[model samples]
Target: MQREPYRLVHSVSSKFREMNHKIGLFGGIFQYAWNNRKVVKNEDDETIFVLVVKRYTTKHEPWNYIRPYEILRKCEK
Candidate 1:
């Protein structure tokens, strides 16, 4: 049987919404894949892309942090 790609939706705050937005999209999809990863092996293991949306905000100039984990938690919300 053919496997299916996962779909995930994510929302980010204005303060942390400036660069690497596509990374956020991939993170969501990866999160879904992590939740439903298969045990069996296959000839090809590839990722599929889906749709994405970004809501405009008045806030700009996002901040940066040393700890990536903290930043990821903030974005995962």
Candidate 2:
């Protein structure tokens, strides 16, 4: 039993401040339409990073949209 490598946490805003990147989810969900914005991959699949989803918050709650704001890092078209 040895399978633990998939980290991607970023919640910046409203004094939350949380950044952790070690992506590895196999292509990282490519893109299936999430809304706010999304695109993560770091297991050889490329796509660098990007996952902003913080539309005005009040410190937890309000449907909680997976709070993510680690934008920047996608220059390899």
Candidate 3:
């Protein structure tokens, strides 16, 4: 079976949004925790998207921080 590709639905952080703008529409990586994901479904019982937290490790930043994200597959019709 084939799997669909992921697309960014929303970003809870301004920093993340800025990063996405810099990356443009063509190609770039958006890091997130696979273990921290929450699945979101539509009324039709199909999975519309997944809600996940941003995954990052900073050498200079503090120990605790969280950023939420919504992602889904951009299906081609």
For this target, which candidate reaches the highest TM-score against the unseen true structure?
A: 1
* Better by TM-score, candidate 2 or 1: 1
Candidate 2, superposed: residue stretches over 4 Å from native: 1-17, 21-30, 34-71, 75-77
Clashing pairs in 3: none
Most accurate candidate by lDDT: 1
Predicted structure 1: lDDT: 0.41
Full candidate order by TM-score, most accurate first: 1, 3, 2
Question: Which regions in candidate 3 have their CA more than 4 angstroms from the true location?
Answer: 1-12, 25-77
* Per-candidate RMSD, Å: 18.6, 14.9, 16.1
Cα distance off (Å), candidate 1, residue 39: 1.5
lDDT of 1 by residue, 1-77 (tens): 47754433333454346335634544564466656665656422342111111111113233233255236746745
* Model 2: worst 10 consecutive residues (lDDT sum): 18-27
Scored against the true structure, residue 73 in model 2 reaches a CA lDDT of: 23
Pull out the clashing pairs in model 1: none
Q: What does candidate 2's lDDT look like per residue over 1-77, in tens digits?
A: 58754443432332332222211121133232233244445333222222211222232233232333223224221
Task: Indicate the residue-level lDDT of 39 in model 1.
Answer: 69
